[model samples]
Target: MRSTTPRIDVVPAPTPAASLVFTTVLTHGPLTRIEISRRTALSSAAVTKAVRPLMAAGYLVEDADEEARPSLGRPATLVRVDGGRALFIGVKVTGDEIIAVLADLCCRIRVARHLPVTDRDPGAVLASISGLVQELLTEAEGFGVEVRGLGLAVSGDVDRAAGVVRYSPFLDWRDVPLVELASTVTGLPVTVDNDVRALTVAEQWFGAGAGISDFALVTVGAGIGCGLVVHGKVVSGAHGVAGEIGHLPIDPLGPPCHCGNTGCVEAIAGDAAIIRRVREATGAPVTDSAGALELAHQGDPGAREAYTRAGEAIGRAIGAVVNVLGPQRVIISGEGLAAYDLFAEQIRDAFTASAFGTAAQCDVMTRPLPFEEWARGAAATAIQSFIGIDTY
Candidate 1:
């Protein structure tokens, strides 16, 4: 039986200056009003005005004075987001599992839960989502805070403005009204976006991408997903499908992708693809990515060779991103990193070979973010919507 959907109380107004001020405070606080003004480049008066409503609503709280503010002629008080002001829920639906987190206003995870996914149909996935959301909602009750919103992160071409999953190749979904359906069942405002894009939000604010204006986040797991942030903003292209690096056609003779394209990066390096290649190379009855990895770990030449090729494909994809966007950094992450040792050399070699000129100098690094962090990224999206900065 479906549980009753509890209603969330606050609906934040999406004001431009207030949103900017609030986010600046979020990423670089507890800081003084003067610091906020300087960082945001808003006039002191504008900062004060923007801080008013937020303070009044108990979202921004003034910290104790660290030093006197003689220059700004204001109280020497540090300001930081009151994380306990409200709470949110973030859900990351992978092909194998559903991960949910209950987070505070600051996007800190207070509680988390994981559930196996036995079915991939929209109805079954929604039911699984509802169950996890209900669990998180119950957990939120212990904090004595209102749960403000829910964020849903799935892989594929997602239309954030429309709250629709235009197409999720991993789940074989098309034109799913995810936000509306999720809101109907959860009774909270929902923000649905591409999983990689959602993770990029957390990366921009809290991970390696912090303070960097331009970078790319590439996830290598069940799928090869890329999220691009250009000029400090997550690029969503005019058609809601920017940064589809996973589908870059590196080889016309390569494997076919679920997107009906051949030789796409994902078709070569994605987890399923790697597993398939491993099975073909070793003639082993590998059923899952874990089994495939185990074979490679056991010193099976064929299995290791499969991962090496996957790395090469990924490196070429990264090279393309650098040549086109010229980002400051490229961060590689995802569950696939569990096998990084097997492919690290190939990735660097191929990237070096394919990158052109100064683009080759782009910093390339790997980060192992658990599925929970992806769920946290989902929560960050909910926080973004609550603060009216859903531009991501």
Candidate 2:
């Protein structure tokens, strides 16, 4: 029987080198073949061979080299991905909201949509995903490009190979076949992945981790999540759950975690933890992280203390990760960065105190990113699948 589900039958990358060459161009594009060779370490012949199919398929294009030197004879043409060749939809499902984006082949977001989550049930979240994907699909048609695939990034343990969300604490879901569900609903192949891991893929290829062989991404907000890239590859762990720094036990007697643990990083530094601490400390009846931040910004001692503790917890958690994985760079991001100022000092102090030996020298920086960036990460995952480069 013919399948009703839409699929991109074309394999954009027939070999691993093809995938590497395409993404290298996508990230650092408009480069001469020689430069592509230098960056990818692929021989000139291999680079040309890999790019041939991509350019033929309209996924790549060539243009006269802009950095050409007349004295150096004929200019070398540059290769770049054709962003208009295809479209992808990326969805980021948070505990309170769903953020979706329509992205081009280059993983550039063309349109973004958001919907508040009134329910966290698989069925309800699926409905929200359906609506947002439909909107993006409609938008894709206007671009005259096929929406090749859909990607879903959710928080928790996700088996990308199986497309199953093993357990999502934020959504209280377990054993859900998200890819199967989303593909059925959207009529497009769906790639399901851990939200933080998906974001790490984007960073590894196109953002801060670009060209860095080892790095870590730590997101602080609804949850304290860490994504690690070691030896130029995103590590998903043997059990499909790596870099779960959020569950690191910092305070055995600190607070109860959603995972039934005491004083895990998430229990101390997650948004809910901050909100709960603020309410208890200040008796302010703060219901959200914003309200908690407002009190802290107003110089409330109790609120300030809450942030101080949270920051220390986060810093200590990061220290543990660094001590173990020895990542070269650690990037801190997410909506919770809004509260960074309140406890920046505490985090620095704690991290410095906890880091062992040269690990303290590792660069640690923060970049404030909206949820849309995570959605874009989801889009990147779709692009990976389309190019047959996904870890799977």
Candidate 3:
């Protein structure tokens, strides 16, 4: 008798140029073969050869238009990834909840699910993730496509190569082999990455940072996290801690951070920090970000003061990033944008005061991305894995 347990079939050698072709279409898709060759620096024959298998495998498709022509006096048919091809599972684990999605190969969310977590322990979180993935896997069965991989996006220092969660402060987890555990439980290949970097990958491929070679994604929420993409690649420092701008020391007398530093960006700008400062200033039991934002919107002096300081701290952090990397743009994101109106002016003022010369010219903008988007970013990581691209 055959074993009853369902299992994920192991993928054979994924195409070599699959990564180059996939990445080309991911960042600059709907392009002709000629354009793909030009962008990826692959020869035209190579692009066609690389794309043929993907098209045959249903992962990519050519546009219907047959009349489009390149400037070189040649008819060029555009090619794009099929968003409905193979499905994928992406999960973003936070302190309070798990956000999961069934995304396509092109990283579009075909379905989404969320589960609240009262427990931060690894076992509990893994149980939650397994249940969610099972649900998505059942959903994919309806679409008649395999769920290729599972991507988990977590906050803090993560070694993507080692597939370990080194230290996640919010979850109180240390040295957890999350990828191995999840893959075992779900019977699917897994890719785990830092939440901010995962978000950066999605942005680089599909969102605001698309086509920009150098840009920064600064997340302000429970913690301050920065993801830097320079020269067309996200920088993961040699030690797996490249853009820890949250821990960058800017003030010596500021509140103490969990990292044992004072006046770090997170210490001043994180949600907990803002709440602590608000309670101290107003003598009110402001319990959460919503309460603080309400007080500030109500013209409460103390609440307004807390946000003002937070804005200044964040702006200074952005200035520091600009001073060092000189990115073409800095994107301010996270759940913190709900309070952006309260501190937008202060952020601009502090950034202007702190930025030096040409660095100040770097575009600073706010973009609100929901947790689903972050999870979709996790799916992006799996796509990278499938294409055999380098990942952190």
Best by TM-score: 2
Q: Tens digit of lDDT per residue, candidate 3, span 1-392?
A: 11123343322235656676778786788887888888888898888788877777777788745566656664667799887777889999999989999998789899999999999999999999999998998999899998888889999999999999999999999999998888778888789999999999999988899989999999999999999999989889998888998898888999899988788989999999999999999999999999999899999999999999999999999998999999999999999999999999999999988999999999999999999999999998887886678744
Clashing pairs in 3: none
Who wins the lDDT comparison?
2
Per-model TM-score, in order, reads 0.94, 0.96, 0.94
Of the two candidates 2 and 3, the one with more favorable lDDT, higher being better, is 2
| Model 2 lDDT at residue 72 | 63
Q: How accurate is candidate 2 locally (lDDT)?
A: 0.90
- Give model 1's TM-score versus the native structure: 0.94
Q: Which regions in candidate 2 have their CA more than 4 angstroms from the true location?
A: 1-3, 8-10, 390-392
Give the Cα-based TM-score of candidate 3 against the true structure.
Answer: 0.94
Kindly list the per-residue Cα lDDT of model 2 for residues 1-392, writing each as its tens digit: 11267665544666899998888888888788899999989998999899998988988899986577577677778889999988989999999999999999888889999999999999999998898888888888898888888889999999999999999998999999998888887889889999999999889878889889999999999999999998888899889899999999888899999898899999999999999999999998899988999999999999999999999999998899899999999999988999999988998889999999999999999988889999999999988888888453
Candidate 1 global CA lDDT score: 0.89
Off by over 4 Å in 1: 1-13, 67-75, 390-392
Ranking by lDDT: 2, 1, 3
